[model samples]
Target: MSDQPPYTWWPAGLRRAGAALGVLGVQWYNAARTNIGATATSTVFEPFVTTALAGAAYARPFVRFAGTGTWTLGRAHFAVGDRSAELLAGASPPGEGTYGYTVTRYTNEAHKGNGLYRDLTLELVEVTNAAG
Candidate 1:
């Protein structure tokens, strides 16, 4: 048998596959753009609140779109169930609140230098009382 390094093209193929896998993951995250967060003391995580208020409800079955959002003190990170999602926003634990916090969406990465992160902000205006 000829000794041609036994499949020299394996590494490249693997790399391409890995890249494709990464893209798939990111796309899944983008499409599942459901941002859910809540207070630390609270055991419930509410994603619907943001969706209803942020006008993202119509965007259900979230498309694989790149975007960015800012987080303040009262808010927590976007979480899928109990697992906090990286694609969504995160909280700074608990502390004083900030003004003018918003989360802006983007279609083109060039819009923001970060590409993935857009200049956005969010605020937690209404906090309903926990059921007794």
Candidate 2:
């Protein structure tokens, strides 16, 4: 018999669900920007799935950044939710639009036994202008 824990398959299952339902993407930054135009030293383009917060209006769009692994974050720029956008260091974030979002809050779910995070959910709020 295998010595692996029964929960070992959980991460793969979650990843599959994310791939199927994750139509949105966000530019994840390793450091917090003091303002919108500030330069980011490091960034990664990651795909994500979005949902409305419970008991919240549609205007307040919420997205969750789920992965089979852990991540470090300081700020995120989500404009248009376009999975095709190329995010580069020093490049400005996308312009304001219907789905433009800013990370307002986040919660991390990590495995206590292994200290590996399984999910990182970022709560997003809509951006109304380019100054965000």
Candidate 3:
């Protein structure tokens, strides 16, 4: 008496197609390289907190991009998911170092297993206003 059905894992593989929407699909933009907004559906909570803590000082902005991107990361890059380049609050700065951002942490946190998909999280670091 096998508890398995006719197809055990077949139902789970269907989600990969929808998940890999940006394998060869989307192109992440690099501002310093070309001056455009792009990349994954990344998060920016820490940056926000940092900025908020600064109150009214001088702190650089942080950007986030997360989603499914087949775009390769150079020394710097992002993971984006659409054709139209949309800019975030403090993204695509005028120049690097003037107010630059970097990936402080990157993690492949989870896998849906519902498809050919894997979950990822990347933490970005940036300057924010000072308490003084």
lDDT of each: 0.24, 0.34, 0.28
Q: Against the true structure, what is each candidate's TM-score?
A: 0.16, 0.24, 0.24
Off by over 4 Å in 1: 1-77, 80-111, 114-118, 129-132
Which prediction has more favorable lDDT, 2 or 3? 2
Per-residue alpha-carbon lDDT of candidate 3 for residues 1-132, written as tens digits (9 for 90 to 100) = 022111100101112233332111112223232323222222222111110121222112222224644433322222222211222333442234564556887778445454554545556676454342
**Best candidate, lDDT:** 2
What are the runs in model 2 whose C-alpha is more than 4 Å off?
1-99, 111-117, 130-132
| Superposition TM-score, candidate 3 onto the true structure | 0.24
Instruction: Give one digit per residue, the lDDT tens place, for model 2 in 8-122.
Output: 0011223334332222322222223211221121112342333222232212112334334443333344434432224332344455235678899887877446663354556
Clashes of each: 8, 0, 13
Order the candidates by lDDT, highest first — what do you get? 2, 3, 1
Candidate 2 colliding pairs:
none
12-131 per-residue lDDT for model 1 (tens digits)? 222222222111111011224554321121112222212222212211211112223322222223322222232124333222253432334434334244665443333234333434
